[model samples]
Target: MALVNQTGSVFWSSNKSTTVVNTVAQLLDNGNFVLRPENDENPEKYIWQSFDHPTDTLLPEMKLVWDLKSGINRFLRSWKTNDDPATGDYAYKLDNRGFPELVIFNNETIHWRAGPWNGKRFSGVPQMKGVGIMRFELQENSDEISYSFEMLNTSLYSRLVINSSGIMQRFVWVEGAKFWNQYWYFPGDKCDNFGECGPFGICNANPAQMCNCTIGFRPKNQQAWDLRDPSDGCVRSSKLDCGSDRFLPFKNMKLPESSKAFVDQTMNLSVCGEICKKNCSCVAYANMKITQGGSGCVMWGGDLIDMRQYDDSEDGGQDLHVRVAASDLGMFSIAYE
Candidate 1:
């Protein structure tokens, strides 16, 4: 029997001969299935390669590639349940927003975002630091965008899996303990909730003030904001003169959602800011580098989304320069400094 859906299709076979085999061997070490010719060394060139066909787990050395020209992307789809291998509602893919970024989806809705790749890790995932047992990479070109990881030290076995609850987790295999140790998981807290604070609003889940508007901006609905409904977001306090507007530097912050931004790989931060200022729609700008001594720039032209304040001591976050009325600059200058 076969069932077809808008985004995916499924097929099933009842015959035992067609589905099962007696000589097949499954290896847990490499997650590969192979069939051998009695005494052959290479196992008949792999009857089934798990790398070609993936479920919800992404193992080391396996590539998650996308072809922009063909509109084809390869990524992990969560299983319906622990017992069922059927595709679930959640999916993980590299999204071509303003810049190429990693996004998790629950059906058509965005479940969470990893922000854009800033020459290191995703801007939103600052905790993915330190010399780990695995090294991750985000590759992008005119043809495609792909996410892959490699084992830095072979002795330390690590794996990334999308669980039934829609959380992506990294686990390390402990040989001595004979169990998997949890390393990290996505959606760390309320701040990790996708677009929780709505457009132009920033969320700092574990902060004295969890949600607030950016500098030079004010809550669109003060009543709604007091009631903990930040969906109204923030709006500019005063109109930008466009001629005298200057970018107010905001240091030690996580960049806003990239989807609303305009990006140019060739431009530096200063030039990018100038380009944004010239346009009345430009709201903010940030460097593309995710490390110390950052370079390049990503500029936002619309409302900022999915922004949060992060603990700089735990993760190396970036700074953002937000546009403001030149007259209002003096009022907020001390706070920014």
Candidate 2:
């Protein structure tokens, strides 16, 4: 069967091998296009669904997923142009590496990241924490990894889209205004750009100098850093002394990139510190869940990338303990014991 437009052009065609006499197709209120037997209304028994194959827009309840067992990745890709429905250069998908996180890609390269889920919201998007209209969820297991959000009020309309210019933004219907209003946007500032300050550098959005080395570290290229170029990142001012190294407490921090991370949900903050202390490669650590006094452990073994410092007044972000040599700690170090 095929769906044709007014111009007699076939926009969609079904290739089902067996045809049922009483099959029916319906457009659900949640934007799902489902094909099922007319007598059956069970969504689980539907033969096929448009939600399983997404294009540019991600409406409420639509999942952005990665099937670990089958290697099938369902994500949103932007249209080439406002007038063109062809595939564009930007894609928003769930990136399952050391830990699962939402990321926007410019073609195949990472452009922006929403950080990892911390039991509440993405570590980088603190705005998701207290959202009253939307409830976000992230599920990870042996079979698959998925990220999705649902509106609390069924009467409301909202959507998340990766636009042609590579910007990921969320919009909500303004019933009174008779138009869609942008609710949120990623790459909100220079600091939101992936690895904006390279590795071991913390980006602070408020200052004239937006990038700086974390406590106990120094710019790898002092001359370049002085010239407002921090692409070279930073290095330890003193070599790590392994067992004798101290942790510098960086409060209100966006956890670093976790492409090479170690996670232990059963561990606590103190034990997590000991675990990192024992492993010479472990450079930083943070609690995986920030609610109810915090819990779990996530440690980074290599250069800490894509980190940012939030203002003390900011509602989102967690504390991160960065390993530094005892001699380099100076006044920046906080007592970990």
Candidate 3:
């Protein structure tokens, strides 16, 4: 038997006994369902609750936690279909690899990445404008790594769900209109496609452009690039002089993949660039921020991957610094100027 509590109480039983006593109370204010003890005034002391067993949607008070020691990962997985509640193929989970970023995956393949967690929000999710209608928090300690959000207004209804197609969406319920309004969607554009541009390539979705080589670099396969095939990526125009190379600031750019890159959050951009220059294997370097008080650096050892242009008019965008040979730097500067 099952019960729903708040505005109306519902009961369902498979047995013949009419005295099957399973009560569910629905709280209209919080949208909570509590399995209560008989004639209990306080709903807080319920025996069982829906908040503890969330399926795909994370309610206001629920914690999406991950416990590495216990092997309990509590991220959301898409449903099988719109009509089915069964689990689907896509899942959103925290990647504890380099700097602890959030990754959405289709089975074993990464579909999208919400870049490393800065002090405030995910570096990749520039959509989080500010703490207005909602606020998010990431709690990481010895026991758990969890993320949760709460609406500033209790009466305002909002939900985050992962659809069966591996898409994450935010929805708001309009009580006056009696409809659900879509607020946001993950994998917002082509740039969100994991490694859409192959190694050593950068995708600039603004103006709807495809992959382009970094300064001082050219397509490894010039013919392929001319044919609109960016999978070939790019190659350095000349070998890095190491001592003579300069770090060119690619202002307002989405940072490249960090899993394969060497990152030191403690070092400033200048210091980081020096370290990269000292290593022959290091191909590029960049500051962790495009804004003021920017600290920390990410160094690319191999080829760069999954870079995109910044669209500050539409999305919150960050900048990156790319290293290049002195001659290439001069050429790029002259051409742009």
Which predicted model would earn the best lDDT? 2
Off by over 4 Å in 3: 1-54, 260-265, 285-292, 331-337
lDDT of 2 by residue, 1-337 (tens): 5689999998887665446678888999999988898889998888888999899899889999999999999999999997798999999998898867888999889999888888889989977876899899999888999988999999999998888988888899999999999998888999999998988999999988999986578999999999988988999888888978988888878888886688888899989998888999988899988878899999998889899988877766788999889877665456642
Off by over 4 Å in 1: 1-29, 32-48, 331-337
Between which residue pairs do clashes occur in model 1?
Answer: none
lDDT tens readout by residue for model 3, 88-173? 88888777654567788898899998776555667667777654788877777778788878899987978888888888888988
Best candidate (score: TM-score): 2
Selected candidate, larger TM-score, 1 vs 2: 2
Candidate 2's error at 126, in angstroms? 1.4
Q: How close is every model to the real structure, measured as TM-score? A: 0.84, 0.95, 0.79
Candidates' RMSD to native: 5.8, 1.7, 5.7
Report lDDT (CA) for all predictions: 0.75, 0.87, 0.72
- Estimate the overall C-alpha local distance difference test score of candidate 1: 0.75
Candidate 2 ranges beyond 4 A from true positions: 5-10, 331-337
Instruction: Provide the lDDT at 251 for model 2.
Output: 80
**C-alpha lDDT of residue 8 in model 1:** 69
